[model samples]
Target: MAITDIPEYAHLTDADIEALGQELDAIRRDVENDRGERDATYIRNSIRFQRGLELSGRALLFGSGNRKIWALGAGVLGVSKIVENMELGHNIMHGQWDWMNDPEVHSTGWEWDNTGPSAHWKHTHNYIHHKYTNVLGMDDDVGYGLIRVTRDQRWKPFYLGNIAYNTLLMLFFQYGVAVQHLELGRVAAGRHPNPDAFKQDLRDVGMKIGRQVGKDYVVYPALVGAVTRSRKTWLRAITATLAANTIRNIWTNAVIFCGHFPDGAEKFTRQDLEDESQAHWYLRQMLGSANFDSGKTLAFMSGNLSYQIEHHLFPDLPSNRYAEIAVRVRALCDKYDLPYTTGPFLLQYAKAWRTIAKLSLPNKYLKGTVDDAPETASELRFKTDPDQRLTATVDPATGRRTGLRTAIGKLRRRRSPVPAIAGQRQAKDVRAA
Candidate 1:
C-alpha cells in the first residue's frame, strides 16, 4: 500500500513536476559552479580538527589509570570518530569533494575509519540506497533488513523484537553497516548468486574488521601497557576504545534514523520507480527523506544531514553547502506546496522510534488504514471520493499554490472535529469500512 503514483500523492501535474525539477536542477548548477576556496578550506580544516582531536584523545588514554582522564579520553575520541565518519569519510565517499580533483579527498581514494570497506559502502550506499531511496524492496536501508520501520513491510513474528533489534543495531551500527553489503541472510539461505564473489567480499570485510579490531583493541592497548608498565592501564585502554566506538555508533545511528524513518518520510513501491523521470526522482527524494532542526555545530556534527532533503537532492554537492541548499529547497517546497518534512531533532528522532515501535504489530492491531497510516500512505488516501479527489489548486486570495500540504491540513480537519482525539475514530471507521 506504499505510494505507487508519486505525482498523485504529491498532488502535482506532470508540468509542475518538471518545473520543480528544473528549479532543483538550477540549484545544483549554481552550487556546482560556485564550489571554490571556502569549500576546500572547510574540508581541509575538518580533517585537521578530527585528526587533532583523535590524537589528543589517544594521548589522554595513556593516563587511563585515572578515572576522570579515561572518561575524558573516551569522550573526545568518540566525538572525533563521529566527525571523521560523518563529515569527512561519508561526504568524501559521496564524491562531494571530487570536484577539487584532490586525491586525498576523492571518493575512490578515501577508505573510511569504519569497519565497512569503502568500495562496498560506495556500491551499497551511494549507488543502491541513493538510487532507490525508499522504494520498499529496493532500498536495503528500509529497516536495514532487520527492524520494520514501516507498515508496508508485512508483519512477521520476527518484527516483534523491533525495539530490541533496533537498540542492538544502534549500538553496533558500524558492524551492521560492514555486513550490510554481504546480505548475510541470503548467503545463509544459499541464495547468493555468486559464491566466488561473495567469498572475496567476505574476505575484504574480514580484513577491514581485523584491522579495526587490532588498531583499537590490541595494538593501542599493548603500546599503552608497554609504556605505562601496568596491566590495569592496558585493560583500561581497550575499554576506552570500546566506549569511544560505542558512542560514535549510537550517535551515527540516531542521525541516520532522524533523517529517514520519521513519520512524514513516506515509503514507496517499485511501481513508483517504473519509468521514473528525473523530476520524479527528485520528488521521491523530498518525500522519502526527513530532516531535523540544528545549529551550525549540530549540522557539522551530523555531516549537514540536518538538511537531509537537500543532501538527497544533491548527494554529490559539498556537504558544507547543504545549509544554503536547504534554504532554496524549502522555498521550492513552499512554491509547489509540498511538505518540507522537518522538526526539532528530538521530535524527529522520537517519531522514527514511534514508527518502529508501532509497526512491530500486525495491521489488525494498528489504527490507520494501509493507505492513510502515519507511517505508510498512498495516493489512494486522496481518492476516497473520485469527484473530490485531493489535488493541487490555486489560492484565489493570495494567488499562491495550494497542494499536498494544504490538502493534508484539510483532510486532518475533516477527520477530527475535536483536536484532542484528532481522527482516532475516523481512522478506525475508515479501516472498518
Candidate 2:
C-alpha cells in the first residue's frame, strides 16, 4: 500500500504544506526571472561540444582498422551520445530553453539521436511521468513495466528474472524507450482501445529505430570500408559504433535508476492525487525522487541529473542551475525537517539494484513490513493516533523543527515490544496538533 495520506506521511499540516509550496513557487519565479544570455550561452556551448566530440569520434572510426583507435573512438562517441541524450536532448525536449525562442533548440523542432520518436517521448516522459511521478498504477516508470522495484507491484514468477530483465533493459535502454509508448503488452493481450493508433505509433517507432540502426551500423561501416577498402575495417567500425551505444545505454540506465528506485524515493497512491494541491505536488516530487553526489565532470556527464530532486521540482529550469537550486532546496528541507534523499553515486545505484533484487521475492520472504520497507511505506508506518493528525513542531530544547525525518528515526529506534504498548503510551510521546 503506497502512501494515501501524503500530509500525514510527511508530518505536514495544510498550512505547512501551502507555505512550503509558496516558497517553492518563489524559487521557480527567481529562476525564471534570472534566465538570461548566460543560460542561453551555456546551452549553445553544450551543443557545440557534443557535436564536435561526435564528429571527432566519427573521424577516428574512419581509421578504426587499428584496435586501439577503435576503442578510443567508441569511448569518445559514447560520451558524446550521453551528453546529447541526457543534457541536451532531455532538457531541450522538456522546453527548458523554450524561452530562448530559438527554433532550432525548441522542444518542437529538436529531434534527439535516440531510437524513440521525440513526439512520443515528450508525451510519455514530460507529461505522464512528471505529472504522475511515483504514484502507483500511473507511472509506468516504477519498473518500466518489467522488473519489480516496489512491493506495491505484485510479485509473480515472471519477476524471477528481475535481474536478467534489468540487465537487458540497461544494455538496450534506447530500444526500451522506443517501445514504451506502444504499450505492447496491452496490444498483445488484445486490450488496446485503438488498434489503428497503436499501429501508427508502432510504425513511427520502427522508422526511427531503422534510421538509427542504418546510421550507426550500416552507413558508417560502409563508408569507412569504402574509404579503407578493408573488410576488417568495416566490421571494426560497426563494432565500435555498437560499443559506443552500449556505453551510453548502460550509463543512462545507471544514472536514471540511481535517481529513482533508491531508498527514500517513496511511492504514492492515486488517492494522494485526488484534489492534490500545487504545494502537495511539490512535496510529492521531493519525497519521490533521490539524488546522487557528483562534481562538475560527473554531473555534466549525467546531464546534471545527479541533482534529480531539483530537476523534478523544476523540470523546465536550466539544467546548469540545479546545483545552486539544490542549495536552497536543501535549506528548505532543513527548515521543515524533511528527508533530503541523496547519497554517493555508487551507493545510490547499489540501493536501487538491491531493491530490484530483493523485490523479486514474495513479500513473505522479505524482512521489512509493507508499511515501513525501505522501498515502500505508507502513513500507517507512523502509528500516530488516527483521531489526531500529528504536525511538525519546533523542539523546545533545540529550537529545531522535528518532522518526518525525526519521526522516521524514532520509528527505527523502537524495539519490537514498543508497538505492543505503543497505544498505552501514545499520548505521552506522540503529540497531536
Judging by TM-score against the true structure, name the best candidate: 1
Q: Please give the distance, in angstroms, between residue 58's alpha carbon in candidate 2 and its true position after superposition.
A: 0.8
RMSD per candidate (Å) reads 5.0, 5.3
Q: Over all chains combined, what TM-score does candidate 2 have?
A: 0.94
Clashes of 1: 0
Q: Residues 298-363, candidate 1, lDDT per residue (tens digit)?
A: 999999999999999999999999999999999999999999999999999998899989988998
- lDDT at residue 81 of model 2 (Cα atoms): 98
Candidate 2, position 248, lDDT: 98
**TM-score of each model, paired residue for residue:** 0.95, 0.94
> Where is model 1 poorest over a 10-residue stretch in terms of lDDT?
383-392
Candidate 1 residue-wise lDDT at 45: 98
lDDT of each: 0.93, 0.93
How many steric overlaps are in each model, in order?
0, 0
* C-alpha lDDT (0 to 100) for residue 300 of candidate 1: 97
- Across 143-176, the per-residue lDDT of candidate 2 in tens digits comes to 9989898888888999999999999999999999
